[model samples]
Target: MGISENINEILLDIKKLSPYPEKVNLVAVTKYVDVETVKEVLKSGAHILGENKVQVLTKKHDELWDYSVNHKWHFIGNLQKNKVKYIAQFIDMVHSINKLSLAQEIDKRAQEHNRVIDVLIEINLFQEDSKEGYDYQDFLNDIPALLTLKNIKIKGLMTMAPYTDNEDLLRNGFKKLRDLKDELNTLYFNDSLTELSMGMSNDYKIALEEGATLIRVGSKIFE
Candidate 1:
């Protein structure tokens, strides 16, 4: 299988541009793309893969049956408490850990599977009434609730900037998440909350510039 040169080029570019140690986890979002395509991406040296829907991920996870390396799977979409068991089984990380109840379920399921699940708390930057993310104002109040959840460990904060092309809004939103991570870190998490998961294919570079330790990229690579 041949790897995508275009994707590799972008990864090379991103790897070089990142100032912090090459420690960031570049999650290759494989939503619309095919499993064989992802295999080629894996061949291109991508260790982590991200999926949006649990059902879709379940299929992808089964289809990619024999990847030999440390291929980690990440759930990057809104996860319901009911789907916790399936996700905890194979996903190495969960990026959209929203409700505290969902987090509790994940902790319980992960513990059942004897695994430590890494998670990123999602904050709704757009403030959309329909969106499922912790609001900025309520964040401090919710910290204790988040900490009490079991088995799952918070790696950092994740936020999806409103779907707009506004550079200013994007910057401020990304910066806010970074700042939130800093504020959260001022306290201790025993395990440590060190990752700031922001940005996608469109604004990942800006996110990297703003201290995002994890970038969930899709179309840029999968296309």
Candidate 2:
């Protein structure tokens, strides 16, 4: 199937799971794909494209200058402090902020650009050695300090469930993220914590069912 067909199929799936499909953000993961492929997805109405590396995002951002005005670019990988400068001016949001120091650096870069950068706190639900994010207790303890940052807005939470054929495990991880988001809202009295950036091509349907506001899909669409 073509990019358009794949996107339509994904949208249909999202509709089946989401109470309000219009509100759900579909971010197409563009890492490793060429600019032409990225444009193909964008042309198919996948306006939000996520890139894992800042250098790649910068190249694509420049290559797709005309389309950039119409689409949103997201940094969805392990962002390094020095690399933050590359995306500071163009990235629409950062979806992998796990530490206060990284958040502080992002804020500093955003300050330099005179823009407020939207960010999601990545939660390491199972403390997996491979994933990067804050544990529950650390997140809670850092809330006050996170709130003190002026240039970064705490949008919500993001998590990557273990890649498994087990549906139960997938649902559990996504559920925890939703629960944490709710808890944080009540504890912090911040209603802006609305986005739940969970799920990918493998388990996005489950993610939607569990209340993921932003679903990052890659291979399925690109294939």
Candidate 3:
């Protein structure tokens, strides 16, 4: 199937999972894909695209600036401090902010650009050895300090489930993220922490079922 067909099919499947499909944001992951394919995804009505690396995102942002005016670009990978400046100007949101220092750097760059950057707090739900995110208790303990930052807005939480075929583990991971969001909302008494940026191509349906408002899918659409 073509890019357009794949997107259409994914959108259809998303609708089946929720009564209000429009609420679920589909961020088409464009990492490792060509600009042509990215354009095809945009042409197919997908307005949000995510990239895992700043260099690639920068190249594409420059090359496709005209085509990207109406689209939202997201940084969905482990971001290095030095690379934050490169993406601060154009990235719509950063989905993997795992530490206060990184968030501070992002805010510094965003202030220089005179833009308020939106970010999601990445939670290490399963305590994976390889993942980058804040542990549950640490995140809670740091909320007050995080709220003090001026140039960045905390939109919500993000998480990655372990790569496995076990349905129970996947669902539990997603559910924990949803529960965490709920806990934070009640603690803060605000709904501004609204986005649950969980899920990927392999397990988006489960993510949606567990209350993921934003999902990132790549190979499923681009390959």
Candidate 4:
């Protein structure tokens, strides 16, 4: 199938797997694809584009500026403080705010742009040293401070499950993140933390089954 067909199939599967399909956002990870390929994704009806690197995202954002009227650009990777200035002007939603200092930098840049950027606190549930996110326990202890930032809106939580084909590991990882989101919402945000940004091309169905509000799919459709 082509990109459009792949997207259609994924969207259909999302509706079948997700408890709240209407609220679930399908973010097509476009980090590996080029500008024209991204255009093809937009044409496929996948309007939310997710990119990992700042330089690539900024370049695509400028090249695809016309599509901005109908699309949203999401930063879905480890963001640096210095690089925040590059995409701070129009980043639709940041799905990888992993630390307090990073959140502060985003807040400062968002203030300069006079915009409130929506962000998700990334949690390294598996505590992998290679992963870029707040450790599970650290995030719990830091939420109070993270919530105090003025220019960035804390949307919810994001986590990447360890790369594995084991269904139990995938489900448990996604469920844990969902549960964490619920716990934080009840304890602090009062049900405001609605999004669970989990899953990717390999395990999105499991993520959706476990209540992921945002699923990032790339190779499945783009490759």
Clash totals, every prediction: 0, 0, 0, 0
TM-score of each: 0.91, 0.97, 0.96, 0.97
Q: Model 4: which ten-residue window has the lowest total lDDT?
A: 62-71
1-223: candidate 4 lDDT, tens digit per residue: 8999999999999899999999998999999999999989998899999999999999999999976448999999989899999999999999998888999999999999999999998998877888988887888788788878899999999997888899998898888988888888889999989899999999999999999999999999965
The residue-by-residue lDDT of candidate 3 on 1-223, one tens digit each, is 8889999988887788854677888999999788888888899989998999888999988889987447888999999998998989878999998988999999999999999999999999989999989998888888898889899999999998887888899999988898889889889727778899988889988888888889899989966
What shift in Å separates residue 211 of candidate 4 from its native position after superposition?
Answer: 0.4
Which of 2 and 4 is the better model by lDDT? 4
Better of 2 and 3 by TM-score: 2
Candidate 1 ranges with C-alpha deviation above 4 Å: 1-3, 188-191
lDDT (Cα) of model 1: 0.80
lDDT of 1 by residue, 130-176 (tens): 77788766776777887886688889889886666788888888888
lDDT values, one for every candidate? 0.80, 0.90, 0.89, 0.91
* Candidate 2 per-residue C-alpha lDDT over 1-223 given as tens digits, one digit per residue, 9 for 90 to 100: 8889999999888899987787898999999789988888888988999999888899999999876437989999999988998899978999999899999999998999999999999999967899998888998888889999999999999997888899998898899888989988988946779899999999999999999989999998977
